[model samples]
Target: MTTIKGELLEGETETGMAAAAQGGQYGAAAERASEAKRALRLAVASSMVSKVCSIGLQAVSIPLFARVLDTDDFSAMMVYFGVTAWLSLVAIGIWPTVTSIAADDRRRGQLAGVLTVSWVGLSAIFASLIVLVLVLRPVLEQSGINLFSARHYSLFTAALVCYAMLTVLSVGEAVNQGQHRQHVNNLITAAGSILNVVFILLVTYFRPPGEEHVDVTLLFVASQAGFILIRVVNMIGVVVRAGWPHAFPGKAFARELARNSWSLLQAQLAVVFLQQGAVLLCYETDMPRDAALLALLFRANLLLHSFVYMINQPLWPIIHRNMLAGDWQWVIRIYRKLATCYVAYGLLAIIGAAFVGGAAVSLWTAGEYPISNKLATLCAVYFALLVTSAASTPVLMGAKAFVSLGNIGMAEFLAAGVLCTILYFADAVSFPHVVEALIAANAMTALWMMPTQAIVRLSRGSLDAQH
Candidate 1:
């Protein structure tokens, strides 16, 4: 026993000095690595809970809104909502870039300034739109659309306010995302819905008792104002938390942000055209049935896709941090993992939507709106394919592979335009034609850029890690 002890002591002595120090260093590193992984797991769990909660909130909120608003009013409000949302992409294309820049140390202080510039720019555009809407008020009111009646002019103006408010809110969202505090955005969104409900009830209650039926236009505008109020409060909180750096727009800073954001905005425009342009096109072609179909499809898919975007909100900051840290290989590996997870989650959602969404939708609409399983199936398929881009594109964005992605986007836009034009000119256009266009466009883009180039690069391994 003594000899064994002696030998052990001798072995310890051999490994004790420099070897022991090296061993201790490795142990500390292992501990840090484990802690990081654990923290990541917690962040993911938090994100999932936030997403589920937000989606559940929307599910409940929509039905309640439907119950309150008459069909024509609800449809008109949605048109206002959808069109404003789709167009705001044009003005706030810099949000993703804001997030990317704010994720890093060098540009962290610049978020405030960038947001100021973006808000000013976007607000001006929205004001121009409001002026144009007012100028064309005569034409619109004569058009016989529910939103266009001279009586509903207040509602149209309110819708414009909603547009500007929502766009400005993106600045705060981008800040949260940059700091990996995306759950706060969800919390604010949930709060906004509550505020919306309260505002509607209050407006109804305060209306003169003789006029029990409050103007649908008033309800629409009030609810939008509620959203804006909540967003303003949240923005103040975020800025306070950030210690309110006076990021007054410096010339160079604005220019740099604009440069980085240009490609991002281009990407946004293309995506908006691909995903939400259906309704506009349908309306333009004078197909109200097709427009209605697109609206329902878009609303449902919007909720479903929210899960992906919610998860992605926390992911980009992590990627950006690593990119700045020069961890290229890690970024690729992370991208592949996230892409797989996103696609898998999307597939599960597709299956659920395809099999059951039609019946659920029919039940919700009381058979007044009987959507088919086949259409659900096709839309779900399109959604699943499209989600692959969420993780992929962010990786490209982090890698600053903007030029490559731009080329890819241009090709996709061209393909979509060609397909959609053909469909538009075709006799007796149907939802299937729209579905075909979506699937074809999504397939072309999703397959080529990240799934092909980025995934292959990851397989080959990261250049940074290799070097």
Candidate 2:
């Protein structure tokens, strides 16, 4: 009986040891998950703060510019800025391709090679285009309304080129982000924002308010130069920290990058057309005060959108990395958390804008232009739609469903563009009516696209797959 009891007791002891080991494993996993959540939350908070400050600075500057310059001057500046904005899409082609490619563990080196070559190619193209446009300025001026002088147009074109270079550097930032280098990326962005603020302050002080006091054209040129210098410095820092190779592209790597980039390029182009195309359409339509009104509304809308962008920006690389690794469960969790935060913040913003935007506008302009109820309401609605769109965009991006997103954007643009074009030519709707059309188009696109993309992502089991 003693021998039998000894063997039985030994078996029980072994069983207890196994159970303890299992419990420890579970505890470690839970702790790891908790840490990931905390890190993501911190990243999101940092992004939001940075974007808010940047957008707020721009918002403040607009009123100052309006006060210092006359309506015609402001409108002319808007046209010049619009041209540069459209060209930016062309100049920054294929850089975002680096983001998704770098996310793949097997392809990071090749992705880096592709990024190097693509950047050179795109930069050359942008430079050539800028030169061509500059050379043809006389013909361009004579053929149209010529909102700005040759000098101003040239400066705008230069700004666009510089912005393109910034876009290339942004790819490095994206790569760092994919590698979970959030802190480094945040530091660079924060520094860039500080530099921009300093530049803006200097511009304001040196330029001062008056028709004869400052050269608006020169101000923009100097600002663009400053922007480009800051971006170059930031890019150098990212490359140094990431140990990215400064080498030419490999043949296989270049091919792979091109393949991945096609979809992204399509999506980006569609977005460019959808957003900047509106400005072009407004210009073409010839509705009275259409450019000025659109610029004002767009500036306000962009500020709100920037806030949403800040919240979502950091998530992009994280999502890309996880999705590439087939970690769907984590992706879903992150998406849900981000969506909840965005919705809450969006609600607060809507309320604040509805209650105070009018008063703020009036004070900023010193009653030079009273905020109409219609304008205020339109701005609020636009911002609300932007928030909803922001909340859904990340899920779509993570699913590699950019093709569908591009299609949806194209459809929205076509619908709104057609309606606006008809109204402008027919003299049916006024400037406000065009704004209403745009708002309705954007909202409609979000309503259809967001749900569809979410369902597709869930159905593919892409959100829950493990790496």
Candidate 3:
């Protein structure tokens, strides 16, 4: 009896020691994790500051352009900008899809082939889109009544090509971010914005005045050329720092990328449709002046949204890496913190915009056409939704909740369509009314979809992690 009791006591002692050692290791890991989170938070804050500065530059320039240029010129330039944005959607192809794949590949030292294939695939898509745009030029020329002249259209096409190339080059930056090179990505984007501003100033100075002045198309082309150069330089730097892969894309790797990239591509396409499609829809249905006004409101909202995105974008890879490691608890905690921060930031932005945006608009436009109270309200609500929705996006994406993301897109589309249709048929739709409808649709979607999808995915992911 004494021998047996002594043996049992020894076993308990050994188990206790093992547990204590494990506890010490866990405590160390937690400390490290906390430190990493602090570092990431600082990075996110820095990125947001940069985004604000970039957005401010854009906002300041708009009023200057508005002052120097006529409404018709501005309207035509908007169409040109819209077309370029649309073309970029097509040209981007599968590069964004490659981000997670490239990250995973890099972990295994297999990223070269994947990166090569992504580049080649995107380049091919860009070429195809250029050809299609050329073929559709006649159709585009008849798209709006305030269409640009042949010279402008040709210049716009050149801008689109340059924009497409820059977008492709930006994939390298994305890959860099995925590999935890956030500082590099931020620096490159900031530098590009700076260069773009310089080019814009030079173009504005040289351009003719009044109706013949302000060649929007040429300015866009020059800006894009500068942007593309910057991105190419940045991409080269990433390659130099990260070191290129040893092999080109293999057949099996290409197949894997295609399969893995489909969901990301679909998600991206859905987003493009949700955001840009709203502007396009407004342009198609509303008068040119109304479309321009709504565009201005959208741009104002986008400034806040862009800030939210900068806050969230750098955190995506971190969330993805944790999820890939099957760390559901950490995922939940991080997501909760991020969601709270986003909501807080969004609320602050809304309040600030409500109070200060009008004054800023007046100052910028020199009271040329003041932003109305209704428009200000619409901008605030729209920005709130944009920020919150963007904040919740990483959660959905991390959980592979592509279906939920798609449904959110569909809901927004249906809501926007119904609202616009109703407003149109009722003939009750002024610019403010249209803007309100857009904000309502966005808020409705975010309110209904984000929480529901997040909860479901979090629950499922948690269970899966346990298994």
Candidate 4:
């Protein structure tokens, strides 16, 4: 071996050169790894702050709207949004797939093209849903709950449009998640929630006085509409800045997205029904107020669930990466941690609802809609069930168990509807009774999730062994 002039001893030239080259590569890799970790830290921190603020704004929003509108109007408004949520689920087309694909696919520009098609195509679907809603108004009204009249039909239509438009932004956020830039999505969504506060204030100020019971509905819809517009624009700017310069591929990719997105649609609809079906069923009863209260109560429980979900959101990419690496131990450990954390959170939720929930409800409604302890307990139970079931989702998603998960979701939806049916024929038909039925139904679904998750883990391990 010969040495280069100024570098190494004469006999060790090849070894020294090889060692130096190896060291250089190692140093570069370590630097890149360090940078990647720093970025993840920042993303997580930014997401936490944004989620906290979003949760805060959203927490106050339900009760504040209750204060601004009369009981009947408030219920109607909640029902409108609740119904629109179901509609929104129909348009979720391929956004999540777009997120996962974005991580490894270097051609981010292709996704921009896909986003355009998804936006336009999904908008058409959403538009049709609005028409269907209009057409079905008579059907729903005939069912005994006259929730939305022609007076607010346009507002509901407009809100649905805003919601459809928002999916474009959601897909973009998914891209950011895949790209490890979650802070971008989290901050923008946080801004939208903050703007909601402004919209609420405007609705409060612009209301025509005594008719706040009804006219405030316009304000509620308007503020949400505005928030949707702003956030959509925010995401548009993010993509443009990313310079997605790839031209649109042929129709094949778009067709693929459309094909798979239908399953996503099913999954989303199942979730909405699982949570809101009870409330929707309540509308079919003489006590529309109970349906509305369940809706509001559902939203309130979202505040508690928000904590677990926002934290879980950041872990998706991390978990996805680990799963790709065949890190079974890490996956198992994290899943266990998630289950334990939710259990603790669930207990915290029950305590808060048991001790302070009634006082908080009274304060919010000013004795107008006094909540019973039983109702609060059932809501707490429902929430605990939500956490328990949802704990398995991220892991399933990491394992690419969507088809199974989607099937489970559909089964749960049918099961939940059955529970509502029982409520419909039950001897006692009060709100608490309705909620109790829902809690029982939701718990059964939650129980199924653990076994499914275990199956996924076992199947994965066996396959790995065979390979």
Preferred candidate (TM-score higher): 2 or 3: 3
Best by TM-score, which number? 3
Candidate 2 lDDT, 234-294, residue by residue in tens: 6676566545665655676556555545655555665566555655566655642566666
The whole-model lDDT of each prediction reads 0.68, 0.62, 0.66, 0.67
* Candidate 1 global lDDT: 0.68
Give per-residue lDDT, candidate 1, residue 308. 66
TM-score: the better of candidates 1 and 4: 4
Q: Give one digit per residue, the lDDT tens place, for model 4 in 223-339.
A: 575458666786677568556546765777766566656666667767688556666666646566787777768777766776666656656666666566555655676677777
Whole-model lDDT for model 3 versus the true structure? 0.66
Candidate 2 lDDT score relative to the true structure = 0.62
**RMSD of model 4 against the true structure:** 5.1
Question: Candidate 1: minimum summed lDDT over ten consecutive residues — where?
Answer: 32-41
Report the poorest 10 consecutive residues by lDDT, candidate 4.
1-10
Best by lDDT: 1
Per-prediction backbone clash count: 0, 3, 1, 0
Poorly placed runs, candidate 4 (over 4 Å): 1-44, 106-109, 128-145, 208-214, 242-245, 249-259, 458-467
lDDT of 1 by residue, 292-344 (tens): 56777777777777766655556656766665554565566667688788879
Q: Give the per-residue Cα lDDT of candidate 4 at 306.
A: 69
